[model samples]
Target: MNSKPVTRIKKINMYKISIIGYGNLGFHLVNHLSETGHKITQVFTRDKTKTRISKNKIDFIDDLELLRTDADVYFLPVKDDALKEVAKQLSLKGKIVAHCSASVEMKVLKNCTENFGVFYPLQSFSREVEVDFKNIPILIEGVNKETSSVLNDIAASLSNEVIEVNQEQRLAVHVAAVFANNFSNYLFSVAEEILKKENISYKILLPLIEETVRKVKEHAPSKSQTGPAKREDDKTIQKHLKFLSNKKELKNLYTIITDQIKSKK
Candidate 1:
C-alpha cells in the first residue's frame, strides 16, 4: 500500500459569549454554552468569587466598565425593568447584544450596539434544577439578517427548535407562556394549600395533574376540558363554592374561572 499524507481538519473559533446576569437563566446559559464547546470570555455579575465552570477559567467582572469589547455576543438576562439601564451602561459599540426577555422589545438594545437582537428562550429556569436545552424553543429576533444569522447559529447549536420571530410574535408567545406555565404553577400551589388544610399530601394530586397534561397533549385543551363547570353541573359548582365560602379569595377565583369555562361551553 502507498503511504498517504494525513490531512487534519482545522477548527473554527466559536462566538465569544459574555453573560451579564447571574440569575437562573444566566446560570443555565453559561453551563449549556460552555458544555457545547463555546468560549465564554467573561461573565458580568456582582459576585466574582463565584464560578460555575470547572474546566476553563472564565473572567468574572462586577463592574460594567470592566466589560471587555472582545466578546462577539453579550447576553443580557437581567430583569426586564432594568434592561434599558443595563444596556445603557454597556459600551459595546459594534458587538452583538441580545436580551433573554420574552416581553421586552428587541429595540431596547439598539443603543448598546449597532448589531443587536433578542435571544429569548421559552422555558422556566431554576438554578438548582437541570434543564435539557435540546428541545427548548429559542426565539431569535435580530435587527438585520447578519444579526439574525449569528443568533440563529448560536441558538441552533443549543436547541433543535430555533425560531426567528418578530417582536410582536415574541410578545404574544410570552403572554401565552405566562398563562400556560406561570398561572398554572400558581394554581398548583393553590391546590397544595387546599390539600394541606385537610392534612393531605399534595402528592395525591400528582397522578391527576399528570393525566390532565396528558389529555391536553393528546387533544385540544378546549376539547379536553372537564369538570362541573364544563359539564353544566350547577349543583356541584354551588356545593364547591359553598365549601370555599370561608376562603373568599379562593371562592372568587373559583367563581370567575367557572364562569369563564361556562361561557366557553
Candidate 2:
C-alpha cells in the first residue's frame, strides 16, 4: 500500500434533523434541508397533517415525550415567547439543539441541552412565498468550539454567507432588520392607503419603489435618499401633512418619520 493519507471528502454530510415547530421559518428549513438529502427523522408540531411536512414519512409526534433523541440536530423555530417553555419540554441531551430567534439568545436553551446553538437566518420567511436560502445570510452562535463548528458547517451548507455573532451583536442586527424590513413595509402600507383615498392605482408606485430600491443597492441608502424629507422642505412636508389631516394617527406617524429623516440630514 502507498504511504498516502486517504482524505475522505463528504459530498453531503447528511445528518438526522428534528423540527420542533412547523411555522414559516421551520417549514423553510425542513423543506430545504430535506431536499439536500439530509434525513428528517422526526417532527413535533401542533398539526401533523400540514401540507409539505406530511409528504415526509417521518415520526410526526405532537407530544415531546414521543420525540426520538437519536437525531443529530433538533431545530426549534417556534415563537420567541414559547421557546423557553418548549425547551423545558424537550429531552435534547447529547444532541445539537438550535433555535431560529433573532432576539432570543442561545442561553434560552440551556435547560434543554448543554450542546445548544442559535441558527438565525437574517431574512423574513413566509410559507406562501418561495425564498432561495442559498443567497440569504445565516447567523449562528454556539456555546463552545465543537458546537460552533458543527453549526457553522450546517449554516454554510445552506447559505453562501454565514456569520458568527455574539448575543449582543445578534440583538443589534435584529433591531436593524425590524427597521429595514418591517418598518419599511408598514410605510408602504400607509402609502397604499393614502393612494387609495385619491383613487390612484398602487401599481403606479411599484416602478418608483423598484427604482428607489435599485438606487439603494447601487449606493448607500443615505446617499440614495430623495423626496422632500431628505431635502428638509418644510413647504412640501406641511402640504403632505395637511393632505393626511383626516387620518390623525397616520398623520402623526408621517410627522414623526419626516422629523427622523430630517435629523439624519
Candidate 3:
C-alpha cells in the first residue's frame, strides 16, 4: 500500500448513462452512445429474453425494483403507453431523466423525478437496420438549464444536428412525421394491394416512389406535386374510384384524399 501511489479517477467529458427499455430506439441510443464514448452503466428493460450486451460491460436490469438511479443521465426510450406507468414505479428523485415519446411532454416524468427532460430522437429506429446519427436531428427539451445542458452534451456528442424544441413544436413535428412517413407507407400498402390484384409487382412503383421523395428533398413538396389530383383530372380520378367501388372504405378514402389533394392544388 505504501509502495503504490493513489491514482485519481479522471472526470473529464465522460458521462454515465442509464438507458431504459430494450426497444429499437433504446438499442440505437445505447449502441450509439457507447460508440461515441459515453459510459452506459445500466440497461433497464421489460423483457430480458433476447437481450445481449456484448459491446460493453454494463448492468442489465429487467426488474423495476433493481433499476439503478446512480447514472448521470437516465434515458427512457420506452413506448408512450408504458412511460407514465414506469415513471410511477421508479423513484429517481434528483436524477436527470428523459423520455423519447413524440406526443407526451416532459411533465410525464414529474412523478419519477424533479429533474427531467425529453430526449426525442426525431427519426424512425429499427434494430435490424444500421443508422448513421451524424446528420440525424435530435430534439431536446429540459426542465431547467442544468438538465438542458446535460441532454445537449449527450446529443451533440453523437449527432451533427441538435435542436431544443418545446412540446408544441415537437407535437407538430410528430404529426408531420406521421404524414411524411406512416401515412405514405399506408398509401404504398394500398398501392401494393391494387397492383397485386392485377398480377403486377409493386416493384413497378419503386422508381416513382424514389423520384417523388427525391423531388421533395430538392424542392418544396407542394411544388413537387404531380399526378391526377395535382392536375385535377376528373376522368382519371373517377376511373380509379370506380375500380375501388367494391370496397366501401377504400372508395371513400380515395374520394376524400383526391378531394383534399385537388383543393390543395
Candidate 4:
C-alpha cells in the first residue's frame, strides 16, 4: 500500500459541511466541528425536532434531494447499517464523503462517491455529556492520496493524535475498543447495582475505580490486577460467590470473567 504521509492544510477556509445524521455522535460532532471554526452548512435529520437548537445556524433539510450540493465534505455519523443506503441515495458526486463508524470499511462508499474515507473519532459520545475534541483521537482512512491528506488535516486541527488506518486494521482496533470501553463500562454498571442492593452508595467505589484505572496507566493490566481471582484464592472466590448468591447472573459473570483473567495469567 501507499506509505506517504498525508499533507496538512495550513488554513481552513469557509467550506460547506453537511452532517447526515443527528444522533449522539453526529450531534456532538457538529458541535465540536463548529467550535473549531468549521462551518456546518446543513444538517439532515430524520426527525425535525432534533434540529430545534441548531435551527438558526443550520438549515434542516428533510428531503435528501433538497440537500445543498455545495458542501465540500459530507460527514455521515449515522449507524453502520444505514450508511451505504444513505450514500447511494444521496449520490454526492465531486464531494468528499466520510463516516465515523469504526467497523465500516472504506469500500462502503464506492457506490456513492470516489472521494470517500473514514473519519472515525476514538471516543465514547453521548448527547447528555459534552466531549472534548482536543483529547480525543481521530483515525482517518482515505481512498486516494488527496482525500487522505484532506481528512488528515481536518482531524489534526481538532485532535492531538491523527493517524491513517486501513479498513482491516480499523476493524480490529474497533473490536478491541469494544472490550476495552463498552465491556468495562458494563462491569461498572454491574458494580453499581451490587452496591445499591447492599444499601451502599456507589460513590464508595469511586476511589477504587480511579486507582484501578490509574494503575493500568503505569503497568500492564495483568500485572496491575489484584483481588482474589488474580491471587488464585479459592476460599475468597467462594466467599464472594456465596455473598452474591441472590444475584445468580452477576455471580456467573464474575466467575466467568475471573476465570478468563486467571487463564490469561
Candidate 5:
C-alpha cells in the first residue's frame, strides 16, 4: 500500500502595503500589518527624522516621488483634512488605495485607483498607547464587490470584527462614535477640571468611570443612565449649575447637556 502526502493551507495571504502617514493610526497600522506577515514596502511622512525609529526596517520616505509603486495596497492614515491632498499625489492606477478616516467619503479615492476603498478602524488611536488590533472593529467600504472582497479579506486578517459598510453607513457610525467616544471623553476632561479646581485628584473618578462603562457594555446607555439629569433631580442639577456659575462656558455646556439628557428620558 502507498501513502498520500498532505498539504498545508495558508490562512492569510500576504500583502505588500505602503503607508502614506506615520501618525498615530499609521504607526499602529504599520505595526499590526507587519506583525500579520504583510510586507510594508514603504512609509511616507512629512518628516521622517521626527518619527520613532522603525524596528521593521520599513523604508520611510519624505518625498512622494520616492514612493514605491510595487505595493498591493497604499494606506493613507493621514488627517481627514489632508487625506485628499495627499491622495492627489499618488498615481497608482491599478493598485488599491485606501484611507483610514471615519468621516471622509470613499469617493475621494475614486480618481486615485480603480480598486480604491476605506479601511476605517472604529476605535480612537494614539501613538503612545498600545491596543489589540484583533479587538477593534474595522469598517471596510470598497467601490465594488471584487474590491470589497479583497478589502474584507485583508480587514479580517487584522481584526476579529470586520464589517462591510457603505459610505452612508460608515458616516453614521462615525457620528455615533463622536458622540459616544469623543463627547464622553470631553465630559471626562470637564470632570477632571472640576476636581482640579477643588484640589481633588482626578483619579477619584476612575472607578466610577470604569463601572459606568461596564454597565453600558452590558446594557444600553439609556438603560444604564443613573445621573442627576437622568433621574430628573432638579436640586442636584441646580447645585451643579451653581457650582459652575463662575465658569460661564462650563455652566452653559452643563445646561445644554442636562437639558438634552432630560429630553432623551
Candidate 6:
C-alpha cells in the first residue's frame, strides 16, 4: 500500500548470490543488483554462451551442483517446468532460495530446503528489451520469517513497488496478467498482420496503442474503454467485421471480446 520508492534505510552486508537461468529477468536482476553493491558470485544457465557479462564479471556454471556452494542466496529464475527438478537436485539447507515464477506455489521449493520463497517480478521480460527495475512491481512470499525478510529486502532493493503476495493471489494476478499482456500483445500481432496484408505500415497503430495504455494509467481500464464494442454501435461493429472477413480467427476474437465487453456493460 505504500507507494514510495524503494528505501534502503539500512544497508545489509552484501550476501554472496547466485542466479539460476541467466535469461531476461535474471540478466536484468544481476545487472541491477551488481550496480547497488550486491555481490553476484555466480550465474547458472543451461546455455552458458548466451549469458551476458556485466562489469562484476559473473562466473557462469552449466552444472547445478558445481554452483558456488557457499552462496548465501540462490535465485531460481528458471522456467516453471524445471523448477521442482532443480529444487530437488540442489542441497540448499542453509541457503535462502527464491524463485521468480508467478503461478508455482512456494511449496514446490520444499524439496530444496525450508528456507524458500517466491520473488516474482510482475512484468514481461524479454532479452532484447532493457528493463527498468525501479518501475517494475515485485511480489514476494517466503515460507519462513527469516527467508521472507531476506526476500522482501532483495525485492525492495530492486523496485519501489514491492508487496508481499501469497500464492493464491499471485496466481490470480498471473491469470489477469495473461489477459492484459499476452492476449493484448496477440491482438497487436493480429493488427500487424492485417496492416501487412493491406500494405499499411504497422507504425500507424503506434499512437493509438500508446494512447490506450496511457489512458488506462490515468483511468480504470473499463472506464477508459472506447470503440464500437464499448458503445454497442452495431453498425460500426458490422463494418469492422466486414473489413476482417478474410481473417476468421481475428474476426471471431473481435466478436467474442466485443460481446464480453457489451455483457460487462
In terms of lDDT, which candidate is stronger, 3 or 4? 3
* Residue 124 accuracy (lDDT) in model 3: 93
Whole-model Cα lDDT of every candidate shown, in order: 0.89, 0.87, 0.87, 0.86, 0.89, 0.86
**Candidate 4 TM-score to native:** 0.87
What does the lDDT come to for candidate 3? 0.87
**TM-scores, one per candidate:** 0.90, 0.90, 0.90, 0.87, 0.90, 0.90
Residue 108, model 6: lDDT of: 86
Model 4 regions lying over 4 Å from their true place: 1-14
Q: On lDDT, who's better, 3 or 6?
A: 3
Q: Write the per-residue lDDT of candidate 5 for residues 134-232, one digit (tens) a residue.
A: 999999999888778878888888999999998889999988998888898999999999999899998999999999989988999878888899999
Candidate 5, residue 73: lDDT: 89
Q: For candidate 6, what is the TM-score?
A: 0.90
By lDDT, is 1 or 3 better?
Answer: 1
Q: lDDT tens digits, residues 1-265, model 4?
A: 8889999866754456888999988888788787787888888898888888662477788778888888899899999999878878878777899988999887788877889999999988888887888888899999999789888877887888988999888888899899998998998899889889889888888899999999999999878889888889999999999999988899999899889878977
Judge candidate 6 against the unseen true structure and give its global Cα lDDT, from 0 to 1.
0.86
Q: After superposition, how far is residue 98 of candidate 3 from its true place, in Å?
A: 0.5
lDDT of 3 by residue, 79-181 (tens): 9998988888878888899998999979989988888999988889888888999878999999999899899888888788999999999999999999999
Which sections of candidate 1 miss by over 4 Å? 1-13, 52-56
Candidate 2 ranges with C-alpha deviation above 4 Å: 1-12, 51-53
lDDT of 1 by residue, 52-75 (tens): 543456778889988888889999
TM-score of 2: 0.90
> How many clashes in each candidate?
0, 0, 0, 0, 0, 0
